[model samples]
Target: MEEVAVVTLEPWHPWPLVFPAIVLATGAVMTFTGHLRERRWVRDIGMVLVVGGGLAGLALLGLLSGSWDQAQRAEALVGLGYEQPTFSGGDGIVGGAPGVIDFHAQRDGELVVGRLVPLGDAQWQVVEGFRDSQPKDSGT
Candidate 1:
């Protein structure tokens, strides 16, 4: 039997993208607290922060998405030791065109949609990755 080498990836770094979400979430918490306390100033400030943070954070997500994709590709290539390899990805949309895909390859690559299943007590596996994550005719 051929042995398949396991490529281990370090812990994922999500801090860059999490900070904005935290800010937006903070706005919500403050808003709720202010409303409960009957503090108009806090409520108003919270509203402003929520709206502003939501918009800004969403925009940042778009950028971060690209960055995340690049990083994933880089790491995978390093692990596989390939000069150019492609993985599934989607359009700017989270997981590609909403329910149409689970993930995308690049800005214009094929979209992949699938659900994860529990392989064991502490193990999970992606159905799509095991089945149809390969490039067909895109020549990626």
Candidate 2:
């Protein structure tokens, strides 16, 4: 028998995508109704809505995809007994490395900062050493 650690990823919410879908449906209906009524202006507006909504929806999907991936990686680190493990990179939309994880852990009876990187197979390795969160000038 072999022992290995396993970390499960959290699922992303699908509700955010629903609004874009609704927008698309509304645009399609508008276009159909406008065409049947022979209103060119209404049809043009509908077309604009469709195109704008489609492009915006595609952009949102891309952003959400990145957020979901980062969230999953963060969850995996949390599963490894890290406290408050969060996805640390640039802004939520853009950032540094793919698997940058910032976490807090207790060491020697004090809270310290730590970093981790994924090593595949549900395994993660701690980066270097833990750093004291307090200012050096502050004596504890």
**Which of the numbered candidates is closest to the native, going by highest TM-score?**
2
Single out the weakest 10-residue window by summed lDDT for candidate 2: 89-98
Question: Model 1, range 1-140, lDDT digits (tens) per residue?
Answer: 12223333233355675676777788898899999999988888888888888888778777776667456534543443334344444323343222211322321244333322323332323334334455569756
Runs in model 1 lying further than 4 Å from the true structure: 1-14, 68-140
lDDT scores for all predictions? 0.52, 0.61
Could you tell me how far off, in angstroms, the CA of residue 1 lies in candidate 2 after the best superposition? 18
TM-score of each: 0.40, 0.52
- Can you write out model 2's per-residue Cα lDDT over 21-87, one digit (the tens) per residue? 7777788888988999999888888888788778878988889977886677666645555555543
Report the number of the highest-lDDT candidate: 2
Q: After superposition, how far is residue 50 of candidate 1 from its true place, in Å?
A: 1.5
Prediction RMSDs, each to the true structure: 9.2, 6.7
